[model samples]
Target: MPIHSFLNYLALEKKYSQHTITAYLKDLNSFQEFCNNEFDKQRIIEANYAQIRSWIVALVNANISNRTINRKISSLKSFYKFLQKTKEIDSNPLAKHKALKVPKQVQVPFSEKEIRNAINLLDEEVDFESLRNRLIIELFYTTGMRRSELINLKLTNLDFANETVKVLGKRNKERYIPLLKPVQNSLKKYIEVRNEMNTNETYLFLTKKGKKIYNTLVYRVINNYFSSVSSKVKKSPHILRHSFATHLLNEGADLNSVKELLGHSSLASTQVYTHSSMGKLKEIYNQAHPRSKKN
Candidate 1:
């Protein structure tokens, strides 16, 4: 089917991650199902804009958020674009479509003190899981990598001599992030315990059963540890990454450098973290500016 072809294009030509490709496939299949049920249309490739609009309206009535609905539409848009590229379709159905409005959300990052408290708590533990979990937190906070990048990290990705770790980021982009002393120490200890398992897994982080770590398991590791030290509503890997970027920016790191370090494709994507650094900027401005001296 054209759906399978489009998926192959995303995988082989576009070089999208498997996780992302799966999301796209799910969105496409959902649209196809909607077409079958509502319009008696078996083929989504033959669907018109009106049917697609009805799908959006249905999603809205079902209480799906605007952001999520937009994402589903975006998947269909890409599918039509792919069909156009391959000459299977002469016109794009979603070319004139405008995305639904989504509210801007500013994610609150963990305070530096909370991060340090969590780390200090883990520092007292001597077990394999504890050591691995500590390294997971440190890696997330220090390297600012996505959960997938950390889970996919292989043994050869580490370069202790150069103090850098090779990360395979989105769209199969590879970038090297320097490792801090604390993370290095944690890695050494974790690997020492990891060696006792005698598993042939090449991935850096693994389960007690010698298998690669899954997404929810990684989230649990972050959530369970931070629950003690943070009262924030969200405690996940992305928050740690946000905290990493915010803390660096707060300490006077350049925006462009942080962008490169975080593997952002554009400055616009990196600018979201700048909102959290405004307080630090205000403090610095008040201290350094030649304005008021008790005027």
Candidate 2:
């Protein structure tokens, strides 16, 4: 099937991450099923905009969020574009379609004080798990790495001599992030305890059984710790990432530099942090400007 071929293209030619490829495949399969059931169409390439619109209407009636529906639409659009590119189809059906308007969601970063307090709450005992968790938090806050990047981190990636850690980001792009003195200290301590396990795991972070850490465990670690420190509705790895970018921008870091640190492919993705920084700017202006505050 062309869908299978397209998925192969995404996996091999595009070099998309497995997680991304899975999502695309899921979206494509969902659309294909809809076309088969609703319009009795056997082939997705034979679908037109009206059939696509009917499926979208059904999605809306099913109460799926517009943001999610838009993502599904994007998946279909990519598929159709691919079909056109391969000459399987004469034209793209979604060429004139506009993305659904998603409401702006401003994610609040944990304050520096909140982060400090959270770190302070870590157990004073320096066990492997404690050290590993501490180092994980520190790495997220200091380096702004995605959870996947952190998960795939290897012992060889940490360059103590150069004070940097190389990260394998999305699409297998590699970037080096500088380590702060505190992060370096934590890493050293964690390694000291980790070595006592005597296992030859190449991955930096490991489970109690000396296995590589997975996504759920990482999310739980972040959520469990941050739940005690901040009252934010969401407590996840990405929040620490948001805190990293927001805090850096608040401290006067340039946008391009922050973009590079976060491993964002484009400046536009990094621009979202500026909204959080704008709040800080307003606060500074109100406090420092003459006659800014009411008597």
Judging by TM-score against the true structure, name the best candidate: 1
How well is each residue in 44-136 modelled by candidate 2, as lDDT tens digits?
888888988998999999999999999999988999888988999999999999987889887989999988877887758587888999889
Candidate 1 per-residue lDDT over residues 55-94, each given as its tens digit? 9999999999999999999999999999999999999999
- Would you list the C-alpha lDDT of every candidate in the order shown? 0.94, 0.92
Candidate 2 local Cα displacement, residue 29, angstroms:
17
Regions of candidate 2 where Cα sits further than 4 Å from its true position: 1-99, 286-295
RMSD of each: 6.2, 6.0
Error of 2 at 231 (Å): 1.9
Best by lDDT: 1
Report clash pairs, candidate 1: none
Q: How does candidate 1 fare on TM-score? A: 0.71
Candidate 1 local Cα displacement, residue 70, angstroms: 5.8
The candidate 1 region of ten consecutive residues with least summed lDDT is: 286-295
